[model samples]
Target: MTEPKIAIALYSYEPQEEGELLLLEGDILTVLEEDASGWWSGESNGKTGLFPGSYVEYVDEQLIESLGLEQFEEISEESNNTTEQDLTQQQGGEFSGQNINDENYVSDEENEKDNTSQNQNQQEIIQTQNFTRNIGGTTMIHDGFIWEEKEPVFKVTIGKTVKRKKLRGMKKYTAYLIHSGNFCVTRRYKHFLWLRQRLVERYENVPVPPMPEKQFQGRFGEDFISRRREGLNRFLNRICEHPILRSSQIFHHFLEADEYQDWKMGKRAAEKQNKKEVPFFKSITCAQEVTKDCDDEITEFKKNITSLDKCLKNVENVATDLYLSNYQDLSASYLKFSKAFLKLGSEAKGIVGKNLDIEGKELKERGKEQRKIFIDPLKDYNRLIQVFIETIKVRDQANFQYVSTHAKYTKQNMGELSGQNRDKLLLKQDKSDRMTNITLAEIELFHYNRLRDSKEILTNHLKTQIEYYRKSSERWKKVKEEVEKIPVIHGSKKLEGMEDLSEPELFDEKIETDTEENQTSNQIDKEIEKNDEDNEEEDDEDTDDEDTDEDDDDDQTEETEEIEKEKDENEKNEKEKDEKENNDDFEKI
Candidate 1:
């Protein structure tokens, strides 16, 4: 075995058998078998690894001589046409294989002749392969490079043939292989070829749409290239350094030097920008203006919300206070009513007992006149009952008025607040809905109960007062009956008393007279009839006059009140209208 030559093939040298003869072909070298029938090994500096003689051929001097005369003759012609200065310039580097085929056994004369003929033959071959034409034709290219037409297209063929005998016994072999499929070399090669084909198709012979006159008008039609040239350079230099184009080393080098830094700086700046918090995007055209308007509206809405909060608080306070006041008044009236009822019960009991006693009382007729002594204060009892009923009516009316007025104002305020606060709740629909949930009826109920409670308290009170009046009348009647039971003498002249009265009888007579002096007493027989007729006439006349005046006055007062209310409302509306007109004019400006 021979060691591969280190000279010339240093880029592809490899060890071989120590005794093998390594032959040379220019900078290429090969190891030969002992018989020298063919080369066993060879190397080239520009290629990977060593090559076997089966795949490589040597260009020795003998082989060069055998190349024939034409190719050499063509080279000689081209070389001769050039000046000596040009030859010197072209031949500045070493040409190492000038004597490669100079055989040691051949005569110098024959060698010279052989060299000359060989050179001529070489020239013809060179010339034959080097013809140039002035022909013009377009050659559509693939990937804009690589003249693929001259090379045989790579292909592999498959025929419908199989190792039937071997596969026959392995029934599931195909299925097994399919199930175990992976990205082995075969699959990878197929995928790589598919991707390559796609890439090639993408870059090949693309068409451009024709530009319309409208699109290419003015400077664009003729000077498009000139005008765009600077932009094109800037794009190539500045923008090409972006990651989309920078992946390829070949492309990366195409960018101008300064543009590389500019692109990097731009990316850094973009990243810095991206790091900042971004606002949510909306589709509004005047987004900034809309946002400002929204902010202003929001500020105003917040102020309104504050005002509403205050109003709600006030409502709560007022409602609570009104309820409490109504409750307190009702409670106070209830206490008063209770006391009056108790007193009335006592009086009624006393009156009933006294009436029974008075019905059993004795009356005496003396002298020529019928003088009656009676018991019971019936007139006082009737008057007290009347007073109690009148007081009750006054109390009930006052309570009803207070409750009605309160309910009216609360309901009106709720309506006005809902209307006036509409602007504040424009964006807050849920809040508005909640506000609408408040009811006029609920406030009405509260006021209604206040009146009911007050009425109940007063009714109870009136009942008690009536009872007390009855009781008082009963007690007075009892006292009157006891007084009338005492014996009395009407004669003042000692008459038929039978002798001079004793000291005791005398004192008794004095007491009887004094008691009679204190009473309007038994003389009411005449006075009662006369007074009854006169009182009846006066009462009828007074009642008729009162009824007529009350009806007339009530109608007149209602008409006056209605007229005044209308006037007030009209004035308020006019003032509001003026304010609104002024606001509208200011807004126009």
Candidate 2:
């Protein structure tokens, strides 16, 4: 048999003339023919040219297939199994590592046991033993992303369990009520963790929403439980929203299974069937509207996801900071403010102190509004973004397989055109095409859903912000008005000159300088406006007599003695004394 002409370049070569092939080290070539001269004519990188015979080393074409297949097989094997903890893929929150797919697999001893009566299943399995039959392939995709729903949404009516009774009255564990749509089942955190694990393992083509990170120490706390419950709800919401996942047997089993034994059987069945490779994708095809070449679409989708994730992540971070700084401790901080004000108001013994109490209560209400209207949804949105990214990553895995198989077929196609090789090539081509189709479908579905979700989440987020700000502004405005109603002498205790604040200081040289200073909490006297006209009449007289130094000084001395006689009563009686003292004390507090 004539060996197939193949050579590996031993040295780099730059083409010096037209029709001469360029050669780099290790460059493979097809040895078309050789002339009697030292120069050898060959095809390299699609160019037919002659090169120095010494620059190339020939190898048997048959070895290439064997070697290439070994490397590709290793890649395929590695992809099937990965050791790194994919924190984002499985139980998103802190969860003990558990393999849902393997844990659910039927064991030898269990298989021998009668499963029919012991299933204790809440819902009946398909009589035909195929759940997909009812699920139908048509519903799994909308423009190619699986499970685009048009009929009715798969909803988790209650995601968070407000109460968890101890399992079997055992203090060691608590069973949370996990409800999906009409089904309600008691499940532990581990069960949810495993569900996510199985999903990540089984659907290399689907992104499993990550659970919230585990809360180790505070897991039992009400706040932690509430947050985790909400997070779990969001996770389930994503699962239900996914067209492919909505009818998942394993997920349904989790939601509807009654006894522990039945849950095990359902888990086993779900996993055993997981060995079947993307059975749901068998009926799916790339739609006509999608681009013919999936590589371009994938590239475009990837770029778009990168930009979108970056933008969303940044927004999520900003919201997180806002929540933490402003609303997380909002209740505690505001209540503390209320305490200080109430204490100061008691000391002031005037309307100013009463108004301070109102201000404090309004602060508390402002914090409450922010947390209710804006904080929760923003947090939910942040978690959703992470889930969306993990889902997008599923396509990367599928793309890898497609690229690997395509490479194998392309290399093998370059080999000897034997009957057996031709058949293998056809199979490889079909597989590559199938992967391409699925990837394209997912890209379309992902893009559409992302846009839809973003619009929905964004609209809700903005509306909440508007509501939160609106309530806060109106509350504070009310506070400002009440603050201004405080009597001048009783408004603030330590504002030395505020009590003497003239209603009309327009003719005074110091008027401009004192204007801003007089307009603070110290000026909360309701009587100021009523005195404006009365005081304005004295403005012209005061300005005209400014240069009568000796007479004005003698008159001031007589008035000072009278003021001194009343100083003791006025000193503690002025609201400025209490207001100033309150401001200083609150700052320290």
Candidate 3:
């Protein structure tokens, strides 16, 4: 029979059913039985029940003895500071069902070798069955990697942009659909900004991937949304992959909480927690022993990591430019080229045209899948590299904190560094060690991931290129075969849809129109001739009458003229005798 093992509770677990043990954080229990399932039979405070092995971490009895009364007293002080009821109200129900809250309430950074059995069981239960299963994790180096499974533990996909209104439509904004597993939540960009701010406040020394920069102009554009959503996805994936951050109560609420009210409550609690100025290092679990020589080792690792970061950044930048300029731009260009050819083929109408249309359609289809296979992977990897660089920076900050704390503590005189002050210094030392362990593990894990991810990305890149060329060749071959099937024709044939071009009918219509015009003109000419003859006859009659009247007047005038001539001759004889006498008398006067 195996001897009973003593374990330390890393979290507060409330029993959801009978036969379950209620575990308070930092409580010690005597473990009686172990199971391949995550449950273990344990006795604590004279009460015996079954508890999840993950809730309480098993400690070596000798190590516990070495920790002695100081550790217990510290635990007791924590208990006194926060009452049982307050702990329940504040943090009990947000355990994510069976999920552990290592950042806020548990120790998740324990050595994996110590909890291999429990770790296996835990991984079996909690998984993200997201469709992006191609993130290969099998056949990887087992050096402090957080995720054991081939895929990410949780997949956070942001899509389905919904324009929403708040406060009776007075305020409007876009909400992105964040779906992970069965639980989905809608969050705005502002909400993500708020989340980023709060996480940084809560975990100053821990790396929190920054969201994409905010922009007011064209914020709702499809391109901007796609870019921002992709960035947000990378942020969530980083947080999810983190050993410490993944266990955060804030992270859990952000991801799995589906209701608005629940989200608000969780948000308020996290913000409130942030205001307390609690040491972030206190919650960190330092499973590995931090030796004095670790600084040199850490320095060496830092040099390598920084060098790697610089090199990787350069590569990522080039890859991004390549994706934008080569893959994305070229894919669209190919599709456009295909569409123009297809249109030409459709317009031309022959066996060759049909082949062109088929080829164009097939080529156009390459754009969508090409983006999926090549562009997406490049983008994902580039974002991951950025996250890595950010983490390295934060890890340096943590190391700086530890160094500062150590320096100050050592500078104190021995007279003053006694009792409670000494105890406080010891706590600081432990916290520093924890900070180092966490940052180192995280850095190591990142390096491990870098190798695998680079392999996958390169593999995908090569595969996409090979497939593209192969498909193009195949399409040309298909067109060649199609061309070979074209039959030779002796004479020209009527084009498709041109059979209704009737030339003889057009000529007949023109002839009929000309004939109708000729008949109408002849009738008009005949009417004009008859009217002219009638007018000429009327004029002749009027002229003859006018001549008859003139002759009558002339005869009358002739008779009157003869009478006047006779009278004038008689008067002239008398006037001639008188005028001779008068002329002689007038000459004398």
Model 2 agreement with the true structure over 1-589: per-residue lDDT tens digits: 2334766654445555777776643456777766544467888656788776656656544554655634423332232222111211222111123222232234466652543232322112112122233224333334443445534557774444544446675655545777665678888778889898777665555566667677668667766676666667777877887766666667777789978899988887666556532333434443322223445666676677667667766765676556544443443333333323322332332334444434444544554444433455455555655665565555555445534543565476653333333333323333334445556655666667667866876676688667766876776676677667766675554743333323443222132234333333223332223233323443556555774776889999999999997996797678778999999999999
Residue-level lDDT of model 3, residues 1-589, one tens digit each, is: 3469876665455565888876655566789988765578989777899987655556655555765645643543344223222221221111212211122233354643544554443333223111111111111223342322333466678868888888999987888888888888998888888787887787765667656667889887776677667667767877777655665667777877788898888888778656543345544433344554555666777677667666766765675555433443343333333322322222333334334434434443454444444555555555545655665566556556545644575466523344333333333344445556556666677676677767876787788778877876786787777667766577857443232223434212112234433343233334334433433443557777897899999999999999999999999999998999999999999
State the lDDT at 78 in candidate 1. 35
Q: Which residues of candidate 1, in runs, are more than 4 Å off? A: 1-429, 439-441, 490-589
Tens digits of lDDT, candidate 1, 1-589: 6654322111111224453332221133434331233234443323333332322222334334664334433443332322111211211112211221122224468755655664565444433431221111112122211121322222121112112224566531100000111211111112223322322232111111111111234432223322222222222322122211222222222222124465455434433332221110100011011112322333453354346445545654553444333333333333323222222223332333334323212100110011001001111122223332333333234334433443454466543222212212211221111111111111222234335534754565466546655765776676687656645667646432122333434212112223331121112222323333433443557777897899999999999999999999999999999999999999999
User: Which structure among the candidates has the greatest lDDT?
Assistant: 3
In angstroms, the error of model 1 at 236 is 90
What is the C-alpha local distance difference test score of candidate 2?
0.53
Off by over 4 Å in 3: 1-152, 166-172, 326-428, 459-463, 487-589
Give the lDDT of residue 484 in candidate 3: 75
